[model samples]
Structure formats: C-alpha cells, structure tokens
Target: MTDAEQQYESSKPLFEKSYPSNGAAEPAGESEPQAADTQQPQFQTDEAFASAQLTLRALVSSKEAGVIIGKQGKNVADLREATGVKAGVSKPVPGVHDRVLSVTGTLEGVAKAYSMAAQTLIDSPPPSASSLSSGTTSIRLLISHNQMGTIIGRQGLKIKSIQDECSVRMVASKEMLPNSTERIVEVQGAAESIRLAVWEIGKCLVEDWQRATGTILYNPQPKEFGSSSSGGGGGGGGYSGPRVRTGNPADFDSPDGADQTQNIAIPADMVGCIIGRGGAKIQEIRRVSGARISIAKQPHDESGERMFTIRGTADENERALFMLYEQLEHEKVRRQMEDQEQDE
Candidate 1:
C-alpha cells in the first residue's frame, strides 16, 4: 500500500466514527485468540485515512446522472477540479436504467464529492429529485455480494442499526447485477444523513476488503470498460483470456443442450462501441463471458433499437449482459468528455 493508503487506514476513526464496535463478551479468563475475520480491523488515529486513495461506486438513474454531469459535463469537471478526486459516469447502457458513477481519490475527497452530488440531487425538481420539499435524496451503491453480509448484519440488525443511527433508510437489492457478484444498496434521507450512511457503509466495505485482500484500498472488479487498453491508469492491471471466436451466435450453444436465451434492446448509435473495432470488443465479451452473443443486422423496429441476443446458461447470460452494459457506459462517458472538450 502507498503511504497515503497507510495513512488512510490509520485515520479511519475520522470517517467511521459511527461504526459499531465489535466487542464481544467472552467467557471470563478463557480468552483464546480469535480469528482475524471475526475481528474488525482497527485504525490508529484520525484525518489521514481520510487521505487514502480509494474508489467508491454507485448506480444512479439517468436523470440524476444528468444533474451530476451538468451541461457539457461542466458539473463533473468542476467537481474534479475543486475536490482533487476523479469522477466518472458510465455511458447509458441499453435496457439498463441506472448508470454507474465512480469517484476515486482520498477518503475525504470522495466524501466531499458525494456530499456535493447529494445536494445537487436534492435541489432538482420532481421525479429526478427524491423529495425537494423534504431536502431528501437517495444514492444506490454497487456493493459486492460477499461484503454485503457485513453491512446487513445477522438477520438485518446491522442494516437497521445503520439506518436508525444515520436517520436514513437503507435497502440491499435482491437481484444481482448481470455477470457480477455485486448488488445495489440504496440509502435515502437528507444530505448529511446520506453522507453518514455512506460513510458507515464504506467503512464496512474497506474492512471486508482488507480482511479478504490484506489491503486498505478496495478496487472493485469490472471497474474498467471501453478504454483503449484493458487495464491502464491505476485500473489494477491487464486482462488476458482465451482466444476469442466470432461468428453466428448459434455456433456457440451449450453441448449439454441446456441453453437459455435472452435479448436486450440496444440503441442503434451505441451498438458500435460495444462491438468495438474489428469486433474485438464483442469477441472479448464472448470469451470472458462464455456466452453466445449476436446483434441483428438491422434495427428491430421504428424505435431504431437493435435486438442483441445472448444464448447460454443463466449465469453466462447475466455476465455477458453486465459486460455489455459496462462497455456502453464507458463509451458514454468518453463521448461526454469529448463533447465538453470541443466546446472549450
């Protein structure tokens, strides 16, 4: 871990003041050493862990996305310039209503960015805003399945405690993201309440990641999509997979004959990015997901959306869908940035 990360680990108290203590009552005089997983990782001091380099992700509705992105992406650009954090919103994925927003930087920077984003959400009008009159908004965080149990606690007590303490309502989705080991957790309330809820949730994520990976920083998977290089720019690393086969989706059906199929409607304009140059992107998706994918040569209807079909086991289909969604979102962010630059 970098020095900043080390400092952030040490300074956890600042951001995680409300995290519940893990003090269990042991049998008197029979204090045998406990397993690391059973214990909560403790931090030394305050302020610095808030400086550790980390990334926090959330799923937001497209309307809320526009508010955070602002006209010509000015709001997001301003967010980065003012807070020293990297903020990115994935491009709109066909069939998916929510876009993934990533904020990467010191703990303090990420918190500030979220606070500003939350305020923006509150100030907006109906439908997009959760409740303007009540000064309330909601943020849906994309959390991995494994870490979720920690946040939910045994029989939902943990999640309830967090909501009661922060004065926010929190819920974890029952449905998982396609090809993903993650699900969304929605927290709603006033901006400050949301901040505290997020802080508590973020603390749990960091601790769980540390226990599993032995590191202070948490790097979520599928965090990179549609970049020129698969894994560059602190994206963790590169991707290497089996040779890709590209052709009719029918050619890759299951040998066991247990095949399930699903179709997604993709906007005509966004299909090219998912297919990538020379079909490299689609091939990669096929290889990684082991799903048979084919896009209609023509638009499905007057709506001008193409029918993208996937054939595989239930697992493969979901994975393929998730990967495809990330590709579109990545492309969307890229185009938005480009447009912003052109206006400048």
Candidate 2:
C-alpha cells in the first residue's frame, strides 16, 4: 500500500453499530441509560470497519473467460459498483498446481467478491478435475509487464477499488524466474471464479489497448533515408555536418512510464474479439492511433505466453485509449439492451 492508502486505512472509520428492540423504545429510552445498541449506532463506524486485506481464490478452464467479462468488463464493473469493491486477479504462484487464481481486498469486499465469483460459477460451472478429486476448480494467468500497470492502476487506486468492490484479492503478481530480472504474473482463485475473473480482465483490457499502424494518424511519420540535398554553406575547409536522423516516437516513452496498454486476464481465445471481424477493427485501431499492436500467442507457456503489445507516440497512445473506451462503451450499451431483452 502507498502512503495515501496507509493514511486512509489509518484514519478509516472503526466504530461498530448495534440495534435495539423497537417495542421497548419508550420504557428503555425515557430517563434511563441508553442501551448499548441505541447509544452507539445501527452500524459500526470506527471499531467495526477494518482496513485489512483479505485473500480469495477461484477456478475455471482457460477457455471460459470471455463469457464473464461481458463486453469490456460491463458485468464485473457492475458487480464492483454493486458491492463496493474492485475485483481483480493476482499472478500465478510457482510450485503450485497450474490451475489456481489468487486475489485480495478488504474483508467485506473479499466476501462480496467471493459471492460474485460464486454467482458466476453457479451461472456457468467449471469442468471437474480427476487429479485433485475436488469438484471445485482453480486457474492461473501469466500477464505482461505493460499490462500489469493497468491492473495496478494509478498509484494503486484502481486495484484498491477492485479489491473493495469485487471481494477478490489482488496483490502484485510477481515471481522470480531463472536467468532474468523480470518476474512472472500470477492470478489464482477458485476454478470457476478465476474463470470469471480472467474473463473480466480480458474485457477490461479491450478498453485500454489500441491498435496503431501506418495510416492517417495525424503525426509526422519517420522517413526512410533519402538522397542528400546540396548545401552550399562551408566557411573554410568545405566541411558539411553529418545529417542527423530523427528518432522513433517510442524513444520518447520511458519503459517505466505510465502504461497506456490495457490489462485483460481472459483466456487467449477472447483476444480475437478485440481484434474484431477479419482484423478490420484492430486495423482501424492501428490506423487511428498509429501504434503497433500485437496480441500474445496462445497456449501460454514460458515461451508462448499470451500477451499484447502497443507501441506508439503520446497522442497515438491517447487515441488508442479513446478508441478502446469508445468501443467498450458502445458494447456496454448493446449488452444492456440484450440483458433487457432476456429480462423481458
């Protein structure tokens, strides 16, 4: 937790609330010492509310993430808004079964997140496993570094929000690997809940990623080497300075700078949805943003892990953010209509 979060926790309301029997209101209240419940409040304020983290887990097959996300996190977002917590996934922990996802949040939030995961699981149960002999499920995800920033959010506020709303716990997804300074991202949870969590992740990422290509992006494009034009300015020894070529726009962005890419933990299968029909939509994203975009390969292994890369200038990056957000907003309205239809 950062300083602000720590401060928020330190100063969070801690009182607890109690209730009194209404039938005894007059006899118990008039000229008598107030009952504990009545003297306090109906809810806990300082003593009742705790600011500690709660751990959660989920499970599901790698293929079912898309169904849970619901078009750019509409379902999960709704869940968070309803529950007052931010639901998110943590990275996979090594030396454990391949099928597990981990998460974290406040106590009540974690409970609520678990409930949401259960709801998703009940909505679509995961496949059973014979190895563990447990009908329950679990799953893990390996995410890209760039994507991690989005999951973590601005100064960790986004993640905290997810923790508070989803009841799911989300810690830094990092693990040490051999021969490299980079760490792996791990997200473990109940099999079915993990499925939904990742699905939500994938949908959320679609809102952040943007495609850029060699198109009408209103920025100056890098030029290929050209024949030199004759220059006549030579004071004494006829010495002409070497031509300086401009650098790539990517040069301006620091590897440690704010991440413009989106984070989605959905199964690799859902990537195509973001790509759109016949790659037309992704192409459009690229055209509009002028950022290079690449999705992670499927069947995630150390070598073939699923991921996406977006490279572009500041304006182009902003453009990508806008396009993805726009697309998600449009999809959200469409889903709401569909939900209304099903309800009717």
Candidate 3:
C-alpha cells in the first residue's frame, strides 16, 4: 500500500478509540468498554455500520441566539435531547455581530436539530405584536454604516422605541457586511408591525440626513448676503451672518492617504450582483464614490472567490466598498429566500 494509505490504516484504531461507537455490540466474551477506557477501541456494529456524524453551521444574530439558547440554555438543551444531537453556539466572531451555531451528530440527528432550530426562529412571536391581525413575516434591512448610530440612538433608545412602538423583533447584526461597513437589521413580526417598523426606520434616516446637512428648520441660521451690504460702500462691516464656506467639503477619506488602495475578495457567484445588470451597479458605485474599482480576471482565493481592488481617497474607497457589500447582502437574502421557497 502507498504510504498515505498505510498511515490512514494505522490511525483507524485511534480514531475509533476517540469517538463513541454507534450502538455497536461488544465482541463475545469481551466486557463493554468502560467510559474511561483509555486504550480500548469500539467499532460500529453491523446494525448501525452506516451511521455517520456531520456538522452543520448557521448564522444568527446575537438576539436570536438568546432565543435559541432560551433562559439558561434550556432551549438548546431540550433540542439536544429531542434530536439526539450535540449543539452549541459560539460567541460572536471578532468583527461580526452574528453568532455561529454548530449542530453535530448523525446525519438524521443533524437534520432534525437544524429543522427544529429554524422553526424556533420562525415561530418565536414578536414581543407585544399579538394584537396585530396580519400574518407573520420576516424582512432584512441594510443600514448604511454611517447611519447605524442614528438608527440605534444614544444608549439604544431609538431601537428600543421602534420595538416598543412597532411591536416587532428587531436584531441588528454585529458583523458588518463581509468587506463593507454596512450591517443587516433583521425584523420579524406581523406584516403590519414590520411595515410600521420600516417606516419608523426610514424616518430616522431622513432625520439624520437633515440634521447632518443643517437643513432642519429647528436650527435657524442667518442667510448669507450678496456683495451689497447694509453697511454700504463695499465696506461690508455689520454682516454677522454665518460666513459662506468656500472650496470642497472635508475629504473624510482614508487615513492611510488618498493613494492608498484596498483589495477585497468576494465569492465568484456574487460578482454578478455587485456588477449589476450590464455593469450598471459597479459603474454607479465608481461614479458616486469617485473610486477606481476593478475586479481581477482570476480567482484570488481557494474558495473560488474573486478579488476587487479599489483605489481612491479613504472615504471614496470606503463608500465603494460599502456599496458593493450592500448589493451582495441583498443578493444573499434573495438567494436564501429562493432556496427556502424551493424546499417548501
């Protein structure tokens, strides 16, 4: 046998010793292996020889994780007992807001556990929205990175207000889009509740924009006067109005310098979403952000993901990156819904 094959054969007993047997029978005249059998190895019996273990991973917002785990992990513990699976949820990834759920067990156990978890997500009723007559539904909102603070409000007051007023379960992801600064906000509840929440969110965005632009009427400012001044004779002395700021606005671009470039990797299939219909989306992003963006012809990662290089001032590059990620997130949700529909 080849060296690799021989090595694998040599490790077979060790592998069997590490894991529990699949309800296998003990050899005749041999006592069942003790739970603390440090050297004894067990093998699958003929009845369950085909049994195999598998792991499934899923992403869920931290808020949803709380529901899945229930009070003091009761929910997850119950699910494990009912489905004969080992389930665990990891803390949110370093930069992402979503936690990772892992279900490991026999194929059937994994499927059962996953289905149960998914149903739990779908069936969990929103707080105080039971009075709404509309059917339940779920939707995801893509919030711009810069606007997230406004939506969340100081000390989470705004989000709390939306939840209490609209009666929908809202979860904002901790992780930004794969390579972008935007995050996903998931809302679930009766259709009417969702609509109200969305409307409220839109209002918040508008208010933030107005505040940023100093367009809100609450903050009045004196209008700038032309060359003709009330003080007469071009002396223009008594003009106490706000000075007319000239030149370009502050470049808030990258701190690494305007010439600094960034490269991001995106899955091959998602490239089309970022490109949009006939490259329209990519072109729009470039125009709006003043960033030169290009995609590589070859796959840049082992996962068959492609590389995109963005060149511009820090701000421009960030804008382009956000736009691309926003589009990608939309595409991801669309595809997931489609798959779920197909399965149904």
Candidate 4:
C-alpha cells in the first residue's frame, strides 16, 4: 500500500468512534431546546450553534438539474431567496448526465432548501418521468460511504425507523461515486415525506460529519486498459476504470504563477466524453479556463492510455484539470450504471 493508504488505515479507527447523539432532548425543566424532531438536530453548546454551518450535496439527473437551475439561473435564485441559503448547481461536466446541487447555510436553511427543491422536482419532473407512478419522486443525496453503518444503525433499525416515520423508501447504493468515498442514498416518496426524511438524514450526517469526512478511503486500483470489451475498439465508450488520483478539488487549484504543463493518462474509452460532441466540450474547457489542452493520437506505450496534455498558467491549468476530473468522474458513474442495467 502507498503511504496515503497506510495512513488512512492507521487513522481508520478514529472515524469509527461513536459520536454525540442527534440532539437528544435535555432535561425538560432545564431549558426548552429547539425542536430537534421538527427542525435541525440541536448543537450541544450555544457556541457550537452560533458557528455551525452545513452544506448538502445531492445528485440530480440532467433534466432535473436543468429544472433546479431554471432558465438563466432564476430557479436557483428563487431557492436562495425562499430559504435564505446559498444554493447553486455544479457546472455541466462533459459526458456526465448527473449534476450536483449544493445548498449551504444553517441546518434549518438546508432543510428548507432541500424540501423546496424536492417539491419543485415533484411538481416539475422531467418529461421522461411522466410514465412513472404519480405523486412520487426520488432524490439522491451524497453520503459518505464510511458513514453508511451509522445511518443504517445496528441491525438496520435507524434507516427502518426513518422510512417508517417519514413514509419514504430509502436505499443507499452499494457503489460509491467514482474515485471518491461518497455514495448516493436515494429517498423516494411524496414531497413532504421526502422532506422529513431528508431532515432526519441530514441530522445523521451532521452528527457524523466530524469523523466521517476525516476518514480517508483508499482509491480502488484502476483496471488495465482494454480489460472491458463493453466500449472497446477505440469507440471511447469503454469502461477504463477509475484513474483519478486525488479526490480533493483543491489539489489542482493554486494561485496563478509560473506556466506549467501536465500529462494525465486517459483511458482510451473516455476520450470521447472529454472531447464532447464535435469538440464542443473540450473547446468549452479551453474557453473557460484559458488552458491549452491536447490529446495524444495514439495510446501511451502498450498500456492503451492516451496522454492528455494540459498547458497553461497554474490557475488556468488547475481550472482545466478540475473540469476534466469532474467530467471523468461523472462519465465513470454513467458508464457503470449503463453496464449494470445491461447486466440486469
């Protein structure tokens, strides 16, 4: 194992330690604490409450994301206005049909925004979802895979209780997001039930955040090039497995300075997504980041990995690389889903 992996293993137990309860009620006469059942889980200390902030991230399909963003970002603006929270959608990653919707604020604002987003989705599902049963919608939130056990509780009691109380169906995906330690927990039901469930789930996350986010998950080894024939033959639809090195977004981002160039090995199959339809995606990346990027015409040696070259100032390169990383991640997830569907 690499140094990082070893360190992660050594520190693994820290995240496994029990956390404080989810705002259990204090003595009745001592003080009337905030309604933890109806609102966010209460922080133990007033100081903690004054300084606390939470950010919730959820995965939405392309169409659903469009609705959340609305035309010219009016929908997101409306959400921010309504919930008194900072609401935003991630930029479209190439070849990735799913986008992340991020809401930041106090726990109360997040819950409100989460509900508003859910309600909006229920009222305005994509046309493709019209065939589904009416009055039901699904929202997928990104939860740390390591914390799944906490959410599940011992013998599955916690999740069961949440489902029973909120009248929602919750399923946490066994598969983590590509190159990351987070997975999707899909909650499906009516808007109100979903809203309640979201609040409960958010509480679980808040309680576990200290240990969960600090826990490091080792990156799974990438498969050898051409190992999967699904999207082989240079079609760029093949699954090359996860080659992303770092999951941290801040790694590439640096203050502008000397010009630099870097080469990343791209699986032969993923080049199509990076390039987009008729090169529009790549061009967009260049336009936005002011970085010059070039793709190798042939595989790097016998590994079948194409050399993706980027050149620019530090900031520009970082920006371009960041976009590429996001694109690759989303594409990986999409392809995995496709393969799973095909297998089924």
Winning candidate number (lDDT): 4
lDDT of 4 by residue, 1-344 (tens): 43322211111111112332443211211121112333444566535543457766788877998887677767777878887876665545446667667667777677778787777887888877534357778888887665676666644556656666677767666556655567777777777777677777777767666435322221222333324322232322344333433323454664567566777777777788989999998999899888889888998667677877888887787677767865775565445434423432
Tell how far residue 147 is off in model 1, in angstroms: 0.9
Which one wins on TM-score?
1
lDDT of 3: 0.51
- In candidate 4, which residue pairs clash? none
Off by over 4 Å in 4: 1-52, 130-132, 214-344
Root mean square deviation (Cα) for candidate 4:
15.0
Residue-wise lDDT of candidate 2 within 40-153, one digit each (tens)? 332244223333443333443333333344456566566667656545421122332222223345545544554565456445554542232233332333333334445544
Off by over 4 Å in 2: 1-138, 174-183, 211-344
Model 2 alpha-carbon miss at residue 179, Å: 8.9
lDDT of 3 by residue, 1-344 (tens): 43322211111111111222232221211121112213222323522311445433445666767777777777788888997876766433334445545555665565456556545655774353224234554455555545566665544455656666666666665545532344566665654455456555654544443222211001011233233221211111121111121123343343656455677666566677778899898999899878898888998546566778877876677567656654654444345333322332
The deviation in Å at residue 26 for candidate 2 is 49
Off-target runs (Cα >4 Å) in candidate 3 are 1-145, 148-257, 300-303
Quote the RMSD, in angstroms, for model 2: 20.5
When sorted by lDDT, best at the front, the candidate numbers are: 4, 1, 3, 2
Better of 3 and 4 by lDDT: 4
